[model samples]
Structures are given as C-alpha cells and as structure tokens.
Target: MKQTALKRWFNSGGPGVWLSAGAVSIAVIMTIGLLAVIAVRGLGHFWPSDVIAAQYDVPGQESHVLVGELVQSEQVPRARLKGAGLPVPDQGPEFMTRDLFKIGNRDISPGDFSWVIGEWLKDQRKPAQLMTLERREWGNFYGYLVNVKEDGNVIAQGEAAWPQLQARIERVQGISDQLDRLEKGEIGAINHGIERLRLRARKLELDGKLDAAAQADMASERAEFDARYKAVESQLAALHADFNRDSLTARDGNGKEIEIGIGKVVHAYQPNAMGTMTKLGFYFQKLWEFLSDDPREANTEGGIFPAIFGTVMMTLIMAVIVTPFGVLAAVYLREYARQGVMTRLIRIAVNNLAGVPAIVYGVFGLGFFVYVLGGSLDRLFFPEALPAPTFGTPGLLWASLTLALLAVPVVIVATEEGLARIPLTLREGSLALGATKAETLWKIVLPMASPAMMTGLILAVARAAGEVAPLMLVGVVKMAPSLPLDGNYPYLHLDQKIMHLGFHIYDVGFQSPNVEAARPLVYATALLLVLVIALLNLSAVTIRNRLRDKYKAFED
Candidate 1:
C-alpha cells in the first residue's frame, strides 16, 4: 500500500514539482553564497586589522623581524610547498600551513606582501606602537613614529611626536585643499578662458574678419586671464611651500628611519593600540573614503567615485535612448504593420539580434558611430578642433548609443509581448468609440504596455551595467582626468571619456601590475557594481509593479 501510494504521488507530478523546487532553491542558495563571499572579502579590506610583529628564523634565509597585518593563512600539501621551492619539514604531516603578510612600505621593500611558512614564525606579537601609514603613493607604510619635524629640524620626538604630527597634518591638509582649489578651480577657469580667447581669434582669422578692434579685444581678454592665472599661481606656490614645511620621520621594524612629507600621508593609526570603538570609527571612515574619494595609486587604492558616477550616468543615458525607439518600433510592428512574410522575417531578425555577440555590436559601434557619424559631426560642427578628434573620439555619447542599439531588441520583444496580451476586444472597443489607431496606442495600449517596457528597461540596465567588453571599444578609459559631467560650461560633456566600474574591475583584476594589491580592490569593485545594478533594477521593478497594479483591470 505504501509503494502504491508513492507511485501514485510520482504519477501525479508531485516528485517533479518538488525536484524543480529543490533545483531553484539550490540555485538561489549558491547565488547568495557567492555574494556573501564577495561581501566578506571586499568589506573586510577596509577594517583596521591588528598589526603583528613576528620574529622569523628560516633555514637558507636571513633571520629578521617582520611587521604588518596578517592578511590570510592557508594549509597546503607538503609536496606543493616543496614544488614551489619552499623548505617544508618532512617530519611534519603531509600538509603545512602558510601565512600571507601585508608588509607595507612598498617604497622600501621589494613588495608589499610576503608568504612565510607557519613553522618558521618563532614569536608573533601585536605591538601596540606599530603604526599603519596610508599614503597617496606606493601603497601603505607599516612603521613606528620616530619624530615630527619642521624645516628639516626635529620639533618633537618620541611620544610627543604623535600629537604634533597630527596637528601639523591637519594644518597641511587645509593648505592642500586650498592648493587643489587654486589649481583645479580658479586657475583652471582662467586657463580655459585663455584658450577660448585664442580659439576665438583663430576663428576670426580663418573668416578674414580679424580687425584691429577684434585683435585688441582678444589681447585684453588674454591679458586679464593671464593676470588671474599669475595671481592663482602665486597663491599655489605659497601653499605648496607651507604644505611641504612639515615632515615626519618613521622607523620600520628593521630600525631604518625614513622621512615622509606630511602632505603625502593620508592617514596614520596604531591599529594594535586602537580600541573597538576607535577601530569601528576608522572602519566607517575608510569605507566612506572608498565611496567618495578619487582613486589613487594606479586605480588600486582610494575611492571609485568617478567610476560609479560614469556607470550610473551611462545606464541612464542608454535607457533614455532605448525606451522611445524600442516602444515606437514595437508599436509599429504590432499595431500598424500587416501580418505577412516581411513582418515575420523582421521579427525573426529582431530575436536573433538579441542573441548576437555583444563584442560584435562593439565593433560595429566603433566603426560606424565613432568613425563615421562622430567624424562627420566633428568636421561639420567643430571644425576648429580638427586633428584633436573632438566628437570623432570614443566618448560617453557613442557609448550610450552603442549600448542602446545592443539593448533595443530586448525592449521590443518585451513591449510586443505586452501588446499581444492586451485582448482584441479592447482595441475594437476603442475604435468603435472613434479612436484612431495611433490615439489608441498612445493612450490606451501604451499605458497598459508600460509595465513591460519597464521590465525591458530593468533587463537592459542589469545587462548594460555589468558589460565591460563593448564599453572598452566605445568610451570607457582606465582613468579619466575629469568626469563627463563637471562644473565646466555645458556641464554634461557627451564627448568625454568615462571611467566605468565594469572596466575598472577588469583593469584592476587583469591588467594591474601589482596583482596582490589589486585583488582585494577587484572584489570590492565587483560588489559595488552588483549593488549599483541591483538598485537600478529595484527602481524599475517598483515602477513596473505599480503600473501592473494600475493596469490589471484593463487586461481583465
């Protein structure tokens, strides 16, 4: 009776349903697990880890002390360690443990990370005075405070040096901020004005319209800009002199002391001495810096604000470009075009376009959009900027257009499906009420189909946000000096190269010279990209759900 019941349950499709459910559950669990791993690896990088000072005595190597954060530890087969040219003890078990240390001071050391056999580490202790110096260049410095100086003379040393160093650093930072403003803001504007005057003169000369009056006016404008530039330059020089006056000397574990400019240090903290509250505050501070600051150290350190801005802006542009075109095309095919051979072939082609390799789209975009269309635009509208390429270069505009082309088919298919689901009686009813086909589509049909459009937009955003290959060919760059949208006139500069998170991840993960240093950044960037896509999709999904709710009665 039990066997018969079980067989009957299977025959009734219960087993199939349960099996499908189990498969979906497993898939969901795997995805969650992957994201969890990424989060742990990425978010943990910013935390203030306790610095460990270890005495090492390895055979065939110099006995010395090492100090830094103990980044990771893993057990490997004894044979593997031997194969890798490490001296593994044969008396031990078949496996041996190894620890990776982030021994910073990259300016002094051969590298920032080193792997040591766990057995060779004799005495490991967390030294309270060990300081971690986060710098703007050459990664980080792990050391102890020696002295604080001004004008090459030691003003404070030993314990007093720490507080003096902090005070001077704050003053130096203020000076640095002033220098940045003078250089990038006031000075930058003056330089831009001078360039405009020069261009104006060139244009007038080209048109044979340069008279004495025009020349005098241009000269006066140039003179004004030059005066402003000189004043800003003088201020900058003074700020730099002041900023460079304060310096600090630090001694590493090897007792070698190096003097670093106060301006070069981003932050210095004694991780081992820090209490839980201090570490928490430091962690959140680092996290905020990562999200808000511009990247330094060859895109390996600092914040990814530019990449984040570029990504969000590009996706928004692509959506704006794709939606109207996709909706119009779908409406024409479904409501206007007659059902025949040509229409059927067109439908097949649209479906196939969705499956086409994304790289192929990138190539087509490079050839047609960047080369042909953009070149023509530059020649016609920006003739003075010739040879510099201007619009004829890979930029945000072309990138957005390329992605729009790549994503339009998805939108079309989705909108068409929505239109098809709308019953025939509604259309007939609208027509009987003296509504034209265009009117019906614009008012009734499109409104009901809006939910599907939003669905397509969500899919497009998800796909486009993660895309790196096509963006490389179109507009994305390793580093953009200025963001596409900035305080400059015509603030939204379409013909500007952008830093994208997807491309940033690719560059850091694969192309970076320092692989170990870039690895954690890769995970962090990947997590941020995923979050960006999720937020974008969630927004679209919310709008879609609302539309679906409002339009459900019409469908019924």
Candidate 2:
C-alpha cells in the first residue's frame, strides 16, 4: 500500500513540482544571502572604527609600537607564512591567527596595511587621544594632535589645539566650497562662452564672412569674457590664500612629527573617544558623502555620484531609442504583415540577434556610429571642430545607441508575443465599428500589449545597467572630467564620455594598486548598482501591473 501510494504521487507529478519549488526557493535564498553579505561588507566601511595602539614583538626583531584600525583577522597554516618568507614562531598548532591593520599615514609608512601574527601583539589599547585624519590625498593619517598653526606661527598647543584646528578647518572648507562654485559654475561658463566665440570666429573665417562688424562683435564678447574670467580668478586666488593659511602638527605612533596643511584634511576625529550616538551620526554622514560626492584618490576614497548619474542617464536614453523601433517592427510583423515563411525567417533572425554577444555590438557601434556616422556629422556641420572629433568619438550618445541595438531584439520578441496573444475578434470588432485598421491597432491592440512592452523595457534596463564589457569599448572611461548633463547650452551634452558603476567595480577590484583599500568600495558600488536596477525594474513593473489590470478583461 505504501509503495502504491508513493508511485501514485510520483505519477501525479508531485515530486517534480516539489523539486522545482525547491530549486526556486534555493535560488531566492542565495540571492538574498549574496545581497546581505555585500551590504554588510560595504556599509560597515563607513562606520568609524576604533584605532588600536599595540606593541609588536617578532622573533629576531626589535619590539615596536603600532597604531591603526584593525581591519580584519584570519587564520592560516603556519607553513603558509614560512613559505611566504615570514618568520613564523613555532606555536598555536600548525595554523596561526593573524590580524590585518590599516596603519594609515601613507606619507610616512612604506605601506598602508600590515599583517601581524596573533602571538606578536601585546598591550593593545584603544587610546582616546589618537586622532584619525581623513585626507584628500595619501589615504588617511593616524596620529596625535600636537598643535595648530596659522601663517607659520603656533596659534594653539596641546589639547587646546583640537578645537582651534576644528574652527580653522571649517573656515577652510567654506573657502574651498566657494572656490569650487566659482571654478565649475561661473568660471566654467565664461570659459565655454569664450570657446564658442573663438569657434564662431573660425567659422566666419572659413566662410569668408569675417566682416569688420562681425570681428568687432567677436572681439567685444571675448574681452567681456576675459574680464569676467580675471575677476573670478582673482577671487579664487584669495580663497586659496585663506584656505591654506592654517596647518596642523601631529605625531604618529613612531613619534614621527609631520605638518599637514589644513586644506588637505577632509575630517579629523578621535574614534576611540566617540560615543555610540556620535559614531552613528558619523556613519550616516560618511554614507551620505559616499553617495553624493565625486570620487577622489584614484577612485578609491570618495563617492560615486557621477557614476550613478551617468548610468541612469544612459539607460533612459537607451530605452527611448529602442522602444519605438522595436514596437513598430513588432506591430508590422504581427499585426499588418501576412504571416508566412518570410515572417518566420525574420523572427528567427531577430532571435538569433538577441543571442549575439554584447561586445560585438560595441565594436559595430564604434565603427558605424562613432567613426562613420559621427565623422560625417562632424565634417558636415561641425567643420571647425574637425580633427578634434566632437561626435566622432566614443561618448554617451554612442553608448546609448549601442545598448539600444543590443536590447531591441528582446523588445521586438516580447511585443510580438503580446500581440499574438490578443484575440483577433477585438481587431475585427473595432473594424466592424467603422474604425480603420490603423486606429484599431493604435487604440485596441497596442493598449493591450502595453504591459508586455513595459516587461521588455524592464528586462532591457536590467541588462543594460550592469553591462560593463560593451560600454568600456564604446564610451565608458576611468574618469569623466564633467558629467554628460550640465548647465551649459544644449544642457545635455551627449558627446561626453561617462563613468559607469560596472566599470568602476572592475577597475577597483582588479586594477587598483591598493587592493585592500578598494575592496570595500567595490562591494559598496556593487550594492548601489543592484539597488538602482531594482528601483528601475520596480518602476516598470508597477506600470506593467497597472496596464495588465486595466486590460485584464480583454485578455480574459
């Protein structure tokens, strides 16, 4: 009876159903686990970690004191350390534990990180007096505040120097912000205007239309821009002077004293002295900075706002370009054109295109879009910018177009499927109501297929957002001097190269010189990318659900 019941269950497909459910559940759990790991590793990086002052005693070497944040710990075989040419003491079984420390002060130390054996560390203490300096360059500095100086003279010493240094840093930061605004906003505008004038003069010269009046107008505009530039430059000079007026003297664990300009310091805080509330506030502040600020220090130490902006802009552009073409093609094939062997062959071709490697599309885009089409555009309309290659270069527009081409087949297939699923009676009924085929398709058929179109778009966006290989070939760069969209005329400059999160991850993970420092940033960027893709997909899914609900009666 038990064997008969088991056989019946198997024959009823219960076992298969259970296996499928199990597989799906495992996949969901793994995805959630992966995201959790990434979040923990990435988000934890922003929290201020206490610095440990400890003495290290290795065999056959003089004892020395070390100060820095303990980043990680691990256990490894003692033979591994010996193989790596490190003197491993005979203790702690065949494997020994080790701690990795981020001993900042890259300016003084030979390296930023150090790994010490567990048996070597002694007298470890979290000293509240130890200050951590987040610098604009050279990673970070961990030391003791000695004094504060202004204009080459000591203004405050000992504990009093801390508050004085904070005040001076605030003043310097204010000046720095002003300087940034002047440089990137007003000064940038003036410089752009001056370039436009120069280009206009060149265009006139090429056309043999440089009359005296035109020359006078051009000269006047140039002079006005030059005057504005000088004024901004003078203001910038004064700001720099004030910004550099203050400095700080600090001593490291090795008692090596160094003087750092206050302008170079981004923040100075004693983590060991910070209360839980203070640490929480600092954590959120750092997280915000990571999200909003431009990257600095070889793309390792700062935020990724530009990358995020570029990614969303490129994906939106791709969607705009792909939708119409894909929809029209699908409409003609499935609605208007008679189905036959030719139609089947075309569908086969499109399915095959979807399977084509993305990098192949990138190569084609470079050759066709940037070189052939963009070069022709430059020669015809922008002759003055020739040789400099405005559109005839890898940029945001080309990247968008490339990704659009890569995603079009998916959209076409989806729209066709949606169209095929709609009842023929609906179209006939609309036509029977004295409606033309065009009107019937637009009003009755396409509306029913809108949900599918959104589904296709969601898929396209998910694929495009994480694509790195193709973009690197077509448009992505290590660093973009300015964003593609800005306050300049033609506000969206599509011909500018852009940074992308995918490439940023690849660069930081594999290409960075300081791998340990860049590791957490890689996780952070990956997490952000996942979140962006989720948000984008959620938006499309919402629209799709609404459309499906509105048209559910027709499907039924």
Model 2 residue 262 CA deviation in Å = 0.7
Q: What local lDDT score does residue 14 receive in model 1, on the 0 to 100 scale? A: 100
Residue 141 CA displacement from its true place in model 2, Å: 0.2
Per-residue lDDT of 171 in model 1? 92
Question: What ranges in model 1 sit over 4 Å off?
Answer: 1-8, 83-90
lDDT of 1 by residue, 1-556 (tens): 9999999998999988999999999999999999999999999899999998888888787998899888889998889988887766667788788999999888899998999888888889998889988988988899899999999999999999888987987798788778777777897678767766777787788779999999999888888888887888888888889988989999988899999998898888898999999999999999999998889888989999999999999999999999999999999899889999999999999999999998898999999999999999988877766677978999999999999999999999999998998888988999999999888878888899999899889988888788888999999999985678757677798999999999999999999988888998999999999999999999999999999999999888
Report the C-alpha displacement of residue 536, candidate 2, in angstroms: 0.6
Question: Can you list the residue pairs that collide in candidate 2?
Answer: none
Worst 10 residues of 2 by lDDT: 86-95
Residues 1-556, model 2: lDDT tens digits: 9999999999999999999999999999999999999999999999999999999989889998899999999998998998988877666588888999999899999889998887789999999999999999998999899999999999999989999988888888788889888988998899889878888988999999999999999989889998998888899889889988899999998789999999999999999999999999999999999999889988998899989999999999999999999999999998777889999999999999999988899899999999999999999989987679889999999999999999999999999889988899998999999999999998999999999999889988988889988899778998874788879998899989999999999998998889999999999999999999999999999999999999999879
- The TM-score that candidate 1 achieves is 0.96
